[model samples]
Target: MITLTLVGIGSGNPEHLTLQAVRALNDADLILIPEKGKAKDELAQVRREICANVLTSDVHIQGFDLPIRNEAITDYDARVNDWHDRIAVIWKQQIDAHLPDGGKVAFLVWGDPSLYDSTLRIADRIQANMPLDVKVIPGITSIQTLTAAHAIPVNTINGPFVVTTGRRLRDEGLPAGIENVIVMLDGECSFTGLNPDGLHIYWTAYAGMEGEINLSGPLSEITDEIIATRKAAREDRGWVMDIYMLVRSTP
Candidate 1:
């Protein structure tokens, strides 16, 4: 039986790691780090760095190439389903190769696994094919970090809020009956799709990492600046992870 621990490492900040997560890291016999190809190796590096700092056991670290999501497939749901299956196979292959006897294996997840992440789903797929037990160690999310950095509560007094992705916000427009929206998993500035009038935007790139950028003001005033800055930052870093919140007052 394979005991899989999906450990949340938080937003690339060692300070955000929970005590439980640290313990899980130390207890694991083998850790799998997914390489999102060479361009996104920084992600794998973060896991390596985190393990280096917190791991107390003689845990073996292994890097596996992550399956690329097929954007050219045109069918979004089918594409994702296929990708998840591919990832599950890769995980099984790595686990079988490293720990033939079945030991404590871990994966460093970005953000809390329960929130808008597919790691759990992939794990479920793995469990379907093999005898496995799964556990998750929670970590601080970019949403929490974003709100904390802005020093504001997520919602207004007696008001509703929605947490969604950039694509959802852009495609669906502002959700009904909610004045505040926290958007993540966005490569494009989904905020630009909205009517800039009467909207207050708070944007943060690399929320917990070094060289973090925070920009806020009326959407109309700072929209262009945010776009230009976001573009320049992505070009400079070759990759960028960002989240933002938009709050509109009840008029």
Candidate 2:
């Protein structure tokens, strides 16, 4: 039986790694790190650095080139589903090649697996071909870092918050009566599409990393600033991972 442990390493901060995550890293027979090409090679490097820092045992570490999503497909769902399928095939090949006998293998995930990440779904696809036992070790999310960096509560005393993607926010405006909205996986500045009046935005890029940048203020006042800052940061770094929270000014 293959024991697949998905360990969340949290944001870019090594200190964000939990005790359980550290233990899981040392306990794994093999760890798979995905290479996201030259543009995002630093991402794979972070995982390698994490492993080097905490791993006390002789755990085998392998880096596999990740499959790029075919942006040519106009259908969003079809494009993403096809991408996940291809990733699963690549995962299976790596696992089979490394662990022919089926031992414990771990994949270091960014943030909690239960969040927007699709590692769990890709693992599910791998299950169709092998006997696998999956485990998740939750770690800090970018949302947590974003909030903590801005020193704000995610929600009001008795209010609820909706966590969603950029595309969804752009397609459908903020949910009615939901004052708190957390946006992720947004490459575009979708918040600019919303009614800036009576809204506040706390935005952060590379939330917990060394080059972290933060902007927070009335949406109307800082929309352009955030967009320009975000653009320049991405251009300088070659890649950027960001998240933001939008809070209605009134109760």
Candidate 3:
């Protein structure tokens, strides 16, 4: 039986690895790190650094080129599904080639697997091809890290919030009657599209890491600053993983 573990290593911070995550990495027969091309090479390098920092034992680590999503498909859902299918094929091929005898293999996921990440879905695709059992080790989410960085609470007293994506915010707008919002995977800084009345924003780039950049203020006043800071962060680091929380009339 092949046991596949998805270990969340937290948001680009090697020290964020839990003791369980460390043990899982060291115990794996093989670990696969996906290279997202030169534009996002730092992402792959961060994974390697995590392994180097933890693994007390000799563990096999391999790098694979992740397949790009087919943009020509013209449909968002179809393109993403097709891309995932292609990625599953690559993952199976890599696993079979490296650990043919059927042993434990692991993949390091950024943030908790239960969140917005698609790694769990991709793993479901792999399971259909062969006998496998999946295990997840949770790590600190950027949402948690973001709130921690600002020393602010995620929710107002007895109030609910929505955790959403940049695409959704752009397409659907904010949820009705929701006072607190945490937005992730937003390349466009989507909040600028909404009414900034009474909205206070807590924003952070590289939320959990030592080199994080944080910004906060009335959304109306700081919208331009946030956009400029975002551009600079991505330009300087070659990539940006950021999240922001919005509170309307905070307590």
Best by lDDT: 2
Residue 194 CA displacement from its true place in model 2, Å = 1.4
Query: In model 2, which range of ten residues has the least summed lDDT?
Result: 35-44
Question: Each model's C-alpha lDDT?
Answer: 0.89, 0.92, 0.89
How many backbone clashes does every candidate have?
Answer: 0, 0, 0
Model 3 agreement with the true structure over 118-148: per-residue lDDT tens digits: 8889999999989989999999899988998
Which candidate's TM-score is highest? 2
Tell me how candidate 3 scores on lDDT: 0.89
What does the lDDT read for residue 70 in candidate 1? 89
Candidate 3: where is the Cα deviation over 4 Å? Answer: none
Model 2 compared with the native: what TM-score?
0.97
RMSD of 2: 1.2
lDDT of 2 by residue, 1-251 (tens): 99999999888899999999999989999999998765458989988999999999999999998889999999999999999999999999999999999899999998889999999999999999899999999989999999999999999889899999999999999999998999999998898888888998999999888899999889999999998998898789887788999999832
Query: Can you tell me which runs of candidate 1 are displaced by over 4 Å?
Result: none
Q: Model 1 over residues 28-85: C-alpha lDDT tens digits?
A: 9999998875445987887899888988889999998887998888998899999999
Q: Write the number of the candidate with greater TM-score, choosing between 1 and 2.
A: 2
